[model samples]
Target: MDHTAADDISHQANAWFALFHGGAPTPEQRAAWSAWMAADVRHAQAYAELENLWAASALLLQPSPAAAPVAPARLSRRRFVGLGLAASAAAVTAGAGTLWLNGVDSPFADLRTAVGERRIAYLPDGSTVEMAGHTAMNLDFSATRRAVELLHGQAFFRVRPSAAGEFSINTQAGRLHTREGEFCVSCENDAGLVAVSQGRVQVLTAGQQTELEEGLSLSFSARATGDIQRAELAQMLAWRNGRLVFFNEPLLTVVDALQRWRKGRIFIMDKQLAARRVSLILNLDHPDQMLDVLSRALAVRTTRYTDLVTLIYPA
Candidate 1:
């Protein structure tokens, strides 16, 4: 256990896993992998450390540790890749060096989720809120501004707009004004996206204003001066179906979307799966059925280590 070489191998293992989990390995990478495996058990041990680190991180992104678990089944390659990315991102943000155990107290006590989880709530204002996995929202509808803070993840709002009142959904980025109709807004960090499914929404910033009509969508990054990206009709409001709808979206992006509602993770075993195009209606209420359909459609296998964990690989 030489400190210098063990530490070096450990870092290299992390890098290798990053690339390996990222895509198909090159011939050289495959060959080097064999040599590394033969060199010593430490190389394998080091890689295991990285993998364990990532797996632990998936828990942090969950909406709540107490949330129900998804049924055990196989996951798709695309879902697997998606979980890897989510775990990596969480590891970086939550400080990979820290140790966290299950059922530990969390500051996000207000709301949380595992992976691929979903929850619904009845609002004080007679509206309904369906919170996506790994998402949080806080309500502080003050006299000046009716605000629903988008802390993280995503949420769909069916607002009962009052005639004498205006509803404003607030995120770290800014505030959204909602009138008599239904809308949904997702916020992450200093950026947020808004979609109007049935009514109109006026998004207000420091000095700019944009309005979305029914069946339209837009994205706003948390920058002092950021422009908005107009969203397509069906693409923007796809969540209404209790599925993460995508059309030609990157595998990485789609996984991120699905991770929002379930307890189990979706890990990609190979990179080739990432580039393949998939079109399926995901039923959040039936995650297992969704996985089964995905496995057959994509020619992959879903392995469940636990009700809360899953990995996708070539069958």
Candidate 2:
């Protein structure tokens, strides 16, 4: 293996993935990445390889690895992850590279689903949580209380009767209180929407409270809570079964939901175009064709820059 040459390109590919995954990137950065990929066929291949690497890691979301099968030394779960990423680094020992990743573990043992991934985690008390893609949350269970915080993204909670005192999802907007219920909460950009699929839950926002039974949803933001709306969330769960259902949903909202099950970013350069409405069913198995369906229907053109970024604008 020619170490020196491929190392620079692979590291650049990973850096581009990190930049695109972070908060919105400026036009210059996007253009630079585009040009970088266009410079050499190898650059494009390196990026494509990275995207496939992420898509192939669905197994990691299965359950926390008891222990890495390869390395002889003991390794914590987080360090193991950094060690995997280190495999793509230039010329360095994985052990030395992961020293920093070890000290950076979340205080409360945060669980997350990467882009294009979903996770099912069974809690200590028999309760289960289903996390949507690009989601992150933390669990803090004690004898007196059981609570999980949705730092970002969406999660479905299946509360167990004998779990503890109370099972609730805490957010900056407010608290979603439930007991022995099946509910979903999606929190993003300082707001959230809660829906009940079974049993009951209460949405406590600000000083007011709203009780929700099966087949109801409440949308709340950091500032105020909206009226209880009828949300067929069970349909949205189609991702679990390799399908996504959309009915008269805003184009931006649809894109946001679908983006979770895919790698990279979808930039709606035209804000007005983002407001267009879409109604369709997308197959999760072939995530790429999702953009195809919308592009043809809305007469909007989708220009995909490899697998790392997609651009949607009026055709």
The prediction achieving the highest TM-score against the true structure is 2
Where does candidate 1 have its weakest 10-residue lDDT segment?
92-101
Per-model TM-score, in order, reads 0.56, 0.63
lDDT of 1: 0.60
**77-140: candidate 2 lDDT, tens digit per residue:** 6765564454345232111111221222233447887666678999877899998776778888
Model 2 residue runs over 4 Å out of place are 1-109
lDDT of each: 0.60, 0.69
Indicate which candidate wins on lDDT. Answer: 2
